[model samples]
Target chain A: MKQFFIKNRISLSVLIAFLIFTGISFFADYQPGKAISKEYFFQFFKEMIFFLPIMFVLIGLGDVWINRDKVEKHIGKDSGLKGIILVMLLSMAQVGPLYGAFPVTYLLWKKGASVRNIFIYIGAFCTIKIPMLTFEIGFLGWKFSLLRTLVSIPAIIIIGIVMEKMVGKKDFTIKQP
Target chain B: MKLLIAFSVIAIVISFIADKRKTFSGIKSGMVMFFKLLPVIISVLIVVSIVLFLIPQEMIIKYLGEESGLTGYIFAAITGSVALIPGFIAYPMAGMLVKSGVGYSVIAVFITTLMMVGIFTLPIEIRFFGRKVSLLRNLFFFIAAILIGLFISLFYNL
Candidate 1:
């Protein structure tokens, strides 16, 4: 129990802070603050509950089914443009929150994906999700969507290259678990 | 949600058929990863909720609207970085802002930073990638977002 609390100290502290805020709001009769916080909490909670399980299961499946050599051969140091494109497509095809991308990126790193490719993947995952793009076009117009997409793709690639240089080649290797 | 259900079902079926032992072990490891990640996730969500509670919608619209000038662009970028609204909701909000006469550049900056920087998710990012890399990535993205906003504003006359 003590170990668990230690491990989750940050979460525990945040939860405590939230509870204190709620108490203060109730006592002070700040109904709007109280109501808004509660509403936001439940909304985020629902999203977490819905997505986290699926994300974990998919990560597990990838970990088991995909081997290091296969990943390295495809997206590793020597994989080059093909590997970058592959990562971009894979990320763009994904349908979930950005937080869900982190675990999968962790798995990819462990499997020996290059730092450049991983950064590209993260950028693409953030901006170019297919389902979201559909909504973007619908709401923001085709011109806006197309222009953003055009600019963002090259921007993401440039960021990836710059990050690779900044972080250096030595930091690319995964530390042993 | 539909996508989540579909993917989960597909993963379960594939895992069961491919190799039972591997599937079980994979799931076990995945759960371990999930638990390890839980603290950061919970903290980030709570922080985001508090931020959302404090920043009213009217304030956002007013500050990010057309007449607010350069300060509006900066405000949009900063707020977008901190706020954790999903893309689906952000689009409609952006549309409303546009309809309400907010500058396209401001909206562009807001959307770009919202996707790229993720101030609320910084802890989780730092946990995974270390402080230097995480901070640099966000810093770089912030600059890129501002540049993108400027380009959009210039090209489209917004």
Candidate 2:
């Protein structure tokens, strides 16, 4: 029990902090505080409900199905432009928040994806998501959306290269918990 | 959401067909990963809620309006970095800001940083990528957002 608690300490503290804030809000402003907290909590909870399970299942499936040797053969350190483009397309097609990319990227790293490819994947995931781009075009107009997309492609590549150089292959190993 | 559901269903079918035992083990590991991530998720949600409550839409519109200049850019970048609003909501809000006379540059900075540089998500990031890489990624994105904003300003003559 103690060991479990220790492992979960951060979560517990955050829960406590949330309760304390909610309590304070209730005491200080009563109706609005309760209403605000409830509204926000439920909104996020709904998103979690919809997305989290799918993300986990997909990660699980990827883990089980993907072969490390095959992955490494295609996208290893010397894989170059082909590997980078493949990773970019994969990330662009991804369907969740940026946080959802973490485990997937970790799996890729473990499977021996180049550090540059991993970083590029992450960078593309953050901005070039297909659904998000459609929404962006709807709201901001196609010109703005297209311009940003065009600019971001090269930007992501440059950032990936810079990050690989800075972090080096030695630091690319996934850290064990 | 429909896409996710469809994908999940397909994945389930594929997993079961390919190898039942490995699929179960995969799910078990995925559950472990989920439990490990739960705390971070809950904490981020709570923090995001509090932030949304504190910074109303009117405030964002007022501060990011055309006359706000460099201060507007900085403010937008910071708020966008910290805010956890999803892209669907964020894009519409940026649209409203644009209609309200907020500069394209400001909106660019806001949207870029909102997506790229996640301050609140840093803890989870550190957990996955380690402190150095997480920090560096955020830092690099922050700089990229500023440059992107500048590029938009020059391109559109804003």
> If you assessed candidate 1 against the hidden native complex, which CAPRI class would it receive?
medium
For model 1 chain B, where is the 10-residue window of minimal lDDT?
B61-70
A43-88: candidate 1 lDDT, tens digit per residue:
8878887788678877877888888999999998899899989999
Q: Go through the candidates in order and give each one's C-alpha lDDT.
A: 0.82, 0.83
What fraction of the true interface does each of the listed models get right, in terms of native contacts kept?
Answer: 0.50, 0.61
Instruction: At residue A124, give the lDDT of candidate 2.
Output: 93
Cα error, candidate 1, residue A123 (Å):
0.8
TM-score of 1: 0.92
Candidate 1 regions exceeding 4 Å error are: A1-4, A20-30, A172-177, B66-69
Question: On a 0 to 100 scale, what is the lDDT of residue A103 in model 2?
Answer: 83
DockQ of candidate 1 is 0.58
Considering only N, C-alpha and C atoms within 3 Å, which residue pairs clash in candidate 1?
A: none
Q: Is the docking of candidate 2 incorrect, acceptable, medium or high quality?
A: medium
Model 2 clash count equals 0
| Candidate 2 C-alpha lDDT tens digits along A57-172 | 77777888899888887787888888888998988888767777888888888788988988899889988989889889999999998888888888899999999999966746
Best by DockQ: 2
Q: Against the hidden true structure, what lDDT does model 2 obtain?
A: 0.83
